[model samples]
Structure formats: C-alpha cells, structure tokens
Target: MAEKFLQAERYEAHRPHVRAVAYRMLGSLTEADDALQEAWLRASTTDIAEVRNIGGWLTTIVSRVCLNLLRARQARREDDIDGVPQTQGAATVVDPAAEAEMADEVGVALLVVMETLGPAERLTFVLHDLFAVSFDDIAVMLEKTPAAARQLASRARRRVRGTPPPTGHVRQSRKREVVDAFLAATRAGDFEALVALLHPDVVLTADPAVIPSPEPVVILGAHTVAKGAMAAIERAAATGVALLDGECGLLMAQGRGLRLILRFAVQEESGLITEVEVLAERETLAGVEVTAL
Candidate 1:
C-alpha cells in the first residue's frame, strides 16, 4: 500500500512533463491524454520500489505507451487504404479548436514533415531531438541498438530539413519567390495578390479527398482558384513551401498529418503559376517526393 501511494504521488508530480512527451509523440491532445492515462495505469501496477530515477522511469513508460499508440494509428491508416473504417478512437469526440491550438504550440512545420516519417522514426526523433532524451535510453524503448536509434532520428531529421531545390526550366530562385509569395498571399487572405501570382487562365486540380466531391475537383480561372485559396487561409498558416518531386510546391498539414501537397507549374517567362495540382489521395501522395527548397 505504501509503495503504491508513493508511486501515485510521483506520477502525479510528473504528469505535466509526461503529458508533454505524449503530446509530442501522438500529436493529438486527446490521444496524448489517453496515452497518459494508460501510462499511469501501467505505472500503478509496476514494481517501482527499486527504481532510482523515478522521472526517467515514468517518461519511459509514457513514451512506450505513446510509441504503441503511434504504431496502432499507423496501422489504422494503412487499413483505411483498403476502405476499412477506423472504428477505434472514433467514439471519442475531439474538439477541433483545441487540436488546432495544440498544433500551433507544437510547431506546425515540424509536425507537417514528421507526418511523413515512420512510427519508429517519429518516436525516435521526438524522444531524442525534441525532448533531448539520450539515444541510449531511446534505443531501449525502440528495441534497437543506440546507433540504430540515432540513424532513425537522423533520417527523420533529413526528411524534416529536406534537400536543396532541383535544377529546372524555371530558375530555382524564381520558383522559391513564387511559392513564398503564394504562401504569404494565401495566409494573408490577399485574394488579388494570389490571383496576380497565378496565370490568367490558371487551372487548379484537386483530388477527391480535398473537395469531397464525387470526382476530383477542377477549378479554372485565376479568380476562381484565388477564391478557394481565401477559404483555406487557416490551413495556409500551417503550410510550407517544399520541393515536391523536383518541383517547388506547398505542403499542407493538419496536426501531425500531411493533408495535401500543392504542386505548381510556373510559366518560365512570366513567373506566374500556370497550374496548381493538389495531391491528397494517399496512394498518389505516397509517390510524391518531398524535399526542402
């Protein structure tokens, strides 16, 4: 009874920190809270009488819980490709405002790039890079050698940083300028400016997942696409310019997931965006390579 009481007290004392770790790992506040509860339940039954570093032990427990949760989430996403409904965690209602708030606090750019990483890579990077947890300790949780754990984190870091811009018909510098301007105008909700950056007859094509229509959406005319861009300002705030399949484009992310990729076709002479291809289908997105510009 005494041991249980002491463990509970310690767990409560470290709840905030543990919750932070879980949030970073899971990216969803609700899921992080769930992972924390699960961690506490496991900690409650563990023999902690001989534990020396109570905080480290508790963090490890929480990390393992979060890691398992990430893996399960990943598996569910894979199943979704086969049209399987994700019943688990569906009943738990999540507040969109809260999730958005949390995503802002966690750095949207990092979360966006991290979404492309594997579960182990995400866990390793979150534990080691964000929290400064030693690779040796993380290796134990991942069942990998310290070097292997380090490698995973390194790979994640590369994805996050992405590669340099590729040589193309349009000047790389001009491509960067256009993408930067487009993102700035979109986030600022400057419709005219956005339209000015686009060709007069610009075509915007989006996968069905983006517009939820029976078929993929094809919006013609610069003004029409600009209007659509206005409605997505909030998402624009979380978007970043990236090299998509050797072309400069924008990556749109929500929470820790890559929601869409916007690839633009720049008119070499005018530097205006002639085409905007919005890729959101899981299969299509998997084939699109993203690198840093």
Candidate 2:
C-alpha cells in the first residue's frame, strides 16, 4: 500500500512533463489528455521494481502510446480512402479555430504540418528533436536500428526545410543539364559541386505535408542549401531526375508509387538554381506525371 502511494505521487509529479510530450506528438489537447491518461494507467500497472528512473520510464510509456495513436490515425485515414467506414471520432473534426489556437500557442504551425508526416517520422522528430530524447532510446521504442532511426529524423528534417516553388522558366533546354549535374553532385556527396549549382541567394521551401512543424523549414543562400543537400546522397539513389510541371527537377518514389517532387526555379542567364521546392503532399505527389527527361 505504501509503495503504491509513493508511485502514484511520483507519477503525479511528472504528469505535466508527460502531457507536454503527448501534446507535441499529437496537436490536439483532447488527444494529449487521452494519451496522458492512458500512460498513467499503464504506469500504474507496471512493475515498480523495474523502473529506475521514473520520469524517463513514464516518458517512454507516453511516447509509445502517442506513436501508436499516430499510426492508427494514419491507418484509419488510409482505410477511409478504401471506402471503409471509420469508427466514430476516428475522423474527428478539429475545430479550425481551436486548431489555429494550438498552433499559435505552440509558436509553430505544427498543427497543420504534423498531418503531413508519416507516423514514425512524426514520433522520431518529436521525441528526438523537441524532447531531447536519445536516438538509441528512440530506436528501442521504434523497433529500429539507431542508424535507421537517425535516418528517419534526417528525412523529417529535410521535409521540414521545404523547397520553394519553381517559376519563370527560360531556356528550358539547359534546365536538364543543370539538374543532372546537381543530382550527380548529390549522388557523389560532393559539397563544392552542389554549391556551384545554386544561386548565391537561393531560397528553399517545403509544404506542411512534408514537415510536421507549424512553420515550414526555409533555407537561404547557395552554400547553406548545398551543404544540407549534400547529405542527401543516400536519398539521391532513389531519386529520378525529370521535369515536373514543365520545369526540370527530380521525382522521388517508393517503388512505382511516386512519393515526392523537387521543382527547381532556375535563373537562365546565370545557369543557377534560384529556388528548390520539394513537395510531398498527397495531391501534389499523386498528380505528378514525369516529363520526358
């Protein structure tokens, strides 16, 4: 009885911290409350003897629950696409005002951006970046290798740092050569080569669908964007250089299913990329038809 009392006290002390983790993992206050409640129940039932650091243990428990909820939500959305009737509250409509408030309160446009991330990407980013949780610990929760977990976080980071929309194409013929050289640099992980292709003050932006944060990740300057993209060598292997919406760029895919599009705004006279927008929202990704390379 005494031990149980101590455990309850400890759990209460950490409730706020636990709830904060849940709120970031899920944008909804109602959902965060639900996740915290579930975490409490699991913590209560867990063996007290096994937990050395109560706060860490509780955080792990709450994160795992949030991860499950995010995955289930994605699954439910997928099911709805197949005409399957979802459970009540499965497709719950978040009040637009409330959603806006949450986003503002968090000082991020995370509310809208979170919907764009895959489940694991969301969890990995939230736990590792926002909460300062270790990747090894995250890997255990995610059932992934630490390297794989790190890769997921890297992908999420790139998604957040979105590409700018391409506009004003001139000398479209030379676009392919520039893009091809860019990909070759990316594949080779050659930093100088990549930087040479970008305009001195280039801008990059991405849609919320690829980034879970409220504000889109935007990068400015040739050198900065180049160094960042150089690390994308592994992803380069999976990318196909092609033309999107009449501009030359890259098409990323998962097997035959197109998953992302990178549209470049080139400065024809200089033969440098002025803007690079990598978009992966469902509508944009789905309607993409590759132009002849």
Candidate 3:
C-alpha cells in the first residue's frame, strides 16, 4: 500500500509533462486527457517498482496510447466518404470552437503543420523533436531500430522546416494567394485544376456539422479529395476568404447565417494547399476571423 501511494505520488509529479506531450501528439485536449487517464490506469496496474525513469516510462505509455488513438481515428475516418461528422459532444460539453481557439494558444500554425504528418512520422517527430526522447526509446515503441526511428524523425524534420514561425500576418497575403487559387479551381469544379492546386498527398478533415454525415470524413490525396472539392462547388462559390484563428481560411454563410469555416495550411515550397479542415459547428464558425478577399 505504501509503495502504491509512493508510485501514485510520482505519477502525479509527472502528469503535467505527460499531458503536454500527449496534446502535442494528438492535437486535441479531450483526446489528450483521455490518453492521460488511460496512461494512469496502465501505470497504476503495472509493476511500478520495475521502472527506473518514471518520467520516461509515463511519456512512453501516454505516447503509445495517443498513437493508438490516432490510428483508430484514421481508420474511422476512412469510411466517412459521405461527410458524416462523428458524434463527439456527449462526453465533454466544452465550447465547440475551443479547438480552433486553441490554435493561437497552442501554436496553431505548428499544430496545423503537424497534422499533415502520418501516424508514425507524427509520433516520431513529436516524441523526438518536441520532447527530446532518445531515438532508441522511440524505436522500441515503434518496434524498429534506432536508425529507422532517426530516419523517420529526419524526414518529418525536413517537412516541418518549411513551416513559417507563425507570424501574425506576415504570410497571410501569400497564403491568401494559394487559398484563392484552390477556391477558384474548386468553384469551377475543375477536377484537374483543383488537383493541381492541392498537394498530391493533400488531406481534408472536417467537423460533423459541416459534413452532416454519421461520421467525420478525412479524405486523403489530391485526386480523391479533389473530387470532394468539386462536389462542393456551390459552397465554394458562396465561401468568402477569411482568417481562421489567424491562419488563412474560408468563411461560409447562408443568407447571413454563418454556416461553416474552412481552415488551411498552405505549403510554402510547392505553393500548394496541403490541409483543409472544415469547422462547421456554429460556435466554432463564430470564432473564426474573416479578412478581405
């Protein structure tokens, strides 16, 4: 009993650190909190005495939990071709726009760039670059060699290097140009043109309110997602250019009723639009900043 109490105390000491790592990996506080709870449950049941570095152990456990969540999320999103938003409000009744509002507070620009990475790449990058986890530890978690883990981090690093430092409006003008091109192509329903405007591996994720389907849709690749973009020509034609949480995006309204918001992460290298996250929750849309087209 005494040992258990001591272990719990130690875990408490590291809880905040574990949480920050989880949030960085998952990009959702609700998911991050869930991951932390899961980690605590696992930690409480394990042989705490066997562990040396409690902090590292807790981090590894939480990261693995977050990775599993991401994989499951990706799997769930695969079938949401109809734009069904996943029903997620029952558990936590916080502000719907809280996620977008967190962008500025949590380095939203970097968070947006991180969303573009794959599960393994994201895990490797977050654990190594942000938290200073050794590649050996990362490899063990990934079931690969240290060299392989290092390589993954290196690849992610190259991509992250292109992300600007999230200056307020220094790049908004340039970003608007990219977003305009994509919108123009989307409004025209020019499949080829839309694909050309998007990165070959572009990703599109959206909230349920905007998508109005049973599950949230996450379409990947320029061609597959471009088809969806083409389908939204009417909405595209009606969308106004806006700044979502300080990043370039689109505002959608229906005769003064603000309907949805489209946030973007435009790539600097190829001048291609890489990510399009639609937030249609009325509250979320309310928080978006609309700028001049």
Candidate 2 structure lDDT: 0.73
Residues 1-293, candidate 1: write the lDDT tens digits. Answer: 88778888988999988888888887777788888888888888888878898889989999999888878888888878766646555434568776765676666656666777888999898888888999999999999999999999999889877766545545877888998999889877787899999999999888888778898888999999888666544566557776677677788666566778888888988999998887788888768777644
lDDT of 3 at 237: 41
Which tens-of-lDDT digit does each residue in 1-293 have in candidate 2? Answer: 98889889999999988888887788666678788878889888877787789889999999999999989988888878775545535433445455434544453323334457888998898888888989999999999999999999888766654443365444666787888898888878788988989999999877776556687678899998886565433456556665565566776543223557678888868989999886878777656544433
Each prediction's Cα RMSD? Answer: 4.3, 13.9, 13.6
Cα lDDT computed for each candidate against the true fold: 0.80, 0.73, 0.74
The model with the greater lDDT, 1 or 2, is 1
Error of 2 at 269 (Å): 27
Clashing pairs in model 1? 162-292, 163-292
Q: lDDT (0-100) at residue 190 of candidate 3?
A: 75
Better of 1 and 3 by lDDT: 1
- Of the pair 1 and 2, which is ahead by TM-score? 1
By lDDT, rank the candidates, best first: 1, 3, 2
Flag regions of model 1 displaced more than 4 Å. 1-17, 42-57, 74-85, 90-92, 104-118, 158-162, 166-174, 207-220, 232-234, 254-257, 267-271
* TM-scores of the candidates in the order shown: 0.74, 0.52, 0.56
User: Quick one: best TM-score, which candidate?
Assistant: 1
C-alpha lDDT of candidate 3 relative to the true structure: 0.74
